[model samples]
Target: MASKLSTTPGEILREGQLEKRSDSLLQLWKKKRGVLTDDRLRLFSRSSERAKELRFHSILKVDCVEHTRKHVYFTIVTIDYKEIDFRCTEESCWNAFITLALIEYQNRRALEGFRRHRLLPIAYEEQEESEEPRSPSP
Candidate 1:
């Protein structure tokens, strides 16, 4: 999967260690190095087999589940109801960066939709004007 990671073209928004919650009772956390892109967030472990990618569209919601003096914990809830935890120190603050990127992506999508809607009406009007015959000037 590491080879496939290079296939996606996007600016690196953030990169750091992200902890995955393994168990509820024990509250075990597994640290994974990750890089967050504009479209997706990819986490890589010691082995390529453990690589995981989380597409922005697949993310249903992102919430700051916990905040402490040392680190802030973020819970990224996916469409499939899978919750992934990421921890960032106060200096890095990856949580805010990810949230802002998601908001920007949504805004761009909305703007594209708006442009498409307006373009269709203008196109139809131009077509109608072009099809009509113009009267000869005296």
Candidate 2:
């Protein structure tokens, strides 16, 4: 198993086993333990290899499938129609963490966009503003 470094430079929020359901068998599930950072969620395999990564920007939304007394099942859907499901203990509150991370990421992106727009000059608007008004002919 090969170990890969995280692409995003952010603090890790949570790291533990998250049960992922099998596509073919609803009864079968797999345990993955990995780091959930501010920008992405990475799942590692038994051999300590990076198995999957879901970035905040790629995720459209997170949904709670079912919440029993002990466990909460949730799914994260990406923009490209990819669905990743996980079951965690109720206390973990993985759904909330994911949502908050996404919100923070979006806010950061919006701020960056605003800053970029400020740096760019509007040529047409500037030309209009610089031109002096002419007097009407009699």
What TM-score fits each model? 0.77, 0.74
User: How do the residues 1-138 of candidate 1 rate in per-residue lDDT, one tens digit apiece?
Assistant: 021222245878678776777657887777778888878888887566476888888887789988899988889988899887777787777788778777766666778899999899999999999999999999
Model 2 residue 14 distance off true place after TM-score fit, in angstroms: 1.4
lDDT of the candidates, in the order given: 0.78, 0.77
Query: RMSDs, each prediction?
Result: 5.9, 7.5
Whole-model lDDT, candidate 2? Answer: 0.77
lDDT accuracy of residue 87 in candidate 1: 79
Deviation from native of the Cα of residue 82 in model 1, angstroms = 3.4
